[model samples]
Target: MTLDVDEIERLYAYPATERPWVRTNFVSTLDGAATGTDGRSGTLGGDTDTRVFALLRSLSDVIVVGAGTARDEAYADYEVDTDLRGRLGLSPIPAMALISRRLDIPQHLLVADNLVVTTADADPARLATLRESVEVIAVGDGEIDWPDVLTIFADRGWTRVLCEGGPSLHGELVAHDLVDELCLTIAPILAAGGAPRISHGAHTVDQQMRLAHAIEADGGLLTRWVRDRDR
Candidate 1:
């Protein structure tokens, strides 16, 4: 079945507020592999996944992602629909935020408008070089503090935060119990052997999620979930 754009928008809608909200979106194989043999999650998505992905992007105020994922995905500047922006009451086109500990980011992604969330102890010279172009926010001294990430977003009035991940970031968010919603696309394929799950980490955090809804299309399944806050 085909999912209508309006229907999909309504399904993924966030509350109309300037409060910090985090939504992590990912596509994985049926066998729980986030990446295929190609070592990238892009291979796991199909046409419907692309539509839903764009829909989610149009709905968000800013796109937050890990630097590794940004590099691997070859992220570029994006133009959002002005009509959608007006309809959603979004202040601007979705801004891109990259969270990095190592500070090894793609030069192309260092566009002036983008935000780079990093730590204080990161390479000062490199950071100084990047400061010439992009806006950099330092959260912690050694590692990225997720709480500070939220604060920065809130201060910027970026209530709608969409995280398109490389799993490690998702894992960190999940560990901190900060993720509010998860949108997962289950592709109908088994990528067996040595592949990571949607969230990867040595530590474990068991968070229950309520299945808000699931839509099947293009031989794949897209599921929306909200954290079971009451649990």
Candidate 2:
């Protein structure tokens, strides 16, 4: 089920619902390693997976990531393609949102376009420094209140949220039952290294999801699963 660029975009379009939609995008090996032996998910993504990933970012209004993933991936300010944005009727640029408890964001990503979602009890000095320029969002005291955070985004018209995770954050989202869709790309190779799974939250919540689409392309399986609203 190989699809061209346009068909891929159409296939992954955000649901036209008023409520906030949290769509997570991740790539894993055939044997279920989130990252390859190189300790990076980028290494496992094939051409089709890469195309779908970029399209997901471009189509969404915001790019959400944890601080570790941002730092590890060396995430910079998100520069979305204007041509793609216009075609998809998306905003000019997808905002970058970093979720961190310590506010340990990189200097390059401290611009106004980037947001730091940190805990309310974060260091005053760090908060003060970020307050001078960036949009600082405080969720909880020690743990993040992801539902509240999503509600805030919904109010801000950032209903189309794209989360590129670092496992822990994805785990938390799953634990809280906040994930609306999961786009998993299964790479062809088998990576048996000590890489973590796609998610790792302490508390577990078993939820059912419906597979919306599955496509085979670029030596990988690109699949989308929509969260089942009914239990």
Residue pairs with clashing backbones, model 2 = none
Taking the tens digit of each residue's C-alpha lDDT, what string does model 2 give over 1-231? Answer: 667878987899898878788999999888889987667899898888877888898889889999999988887654556898887677798888999987888888889888889888889999999989899989787987787888888888898999999899999999888899999998898877688999997887888989998888887789999997832
Evaluate residue 150 in candidate 2 and report its C-alpha lDDT on the 0 to 100 scale.
Answer: 82
Q: Give the TM-scores of the predictions, in the order they appear.
A: 0.95, 0.95
Query: RMSDs, each prediction?
Result: 1.7, 1.6
lDDT of each: 0.86, 0.87
Weakest 10 consecutive residues of candidate 2 by summed lDDT: 73-82
Residues 115-222 of candidate 1 have per-residue lDDT tens digits of 899998888998898888899988787778888878878897888999998799899888888889999999999889888888987698789898988889889898
Give the poorly placed runs of model 2, Cα more than 4 Å off.
none
Q: Residue 195: error of model 1 in Å?
A: 1.8
The parts of candidate 1 lying over 4 Å away from their true place are none
- Spell out the clash pairs found in candidate 1: none
Candidate 2 Cα RMSD after full superposition onto the native fold (Å): 1.6
Please give the clash total of every predicted structure, in order. 0, 0
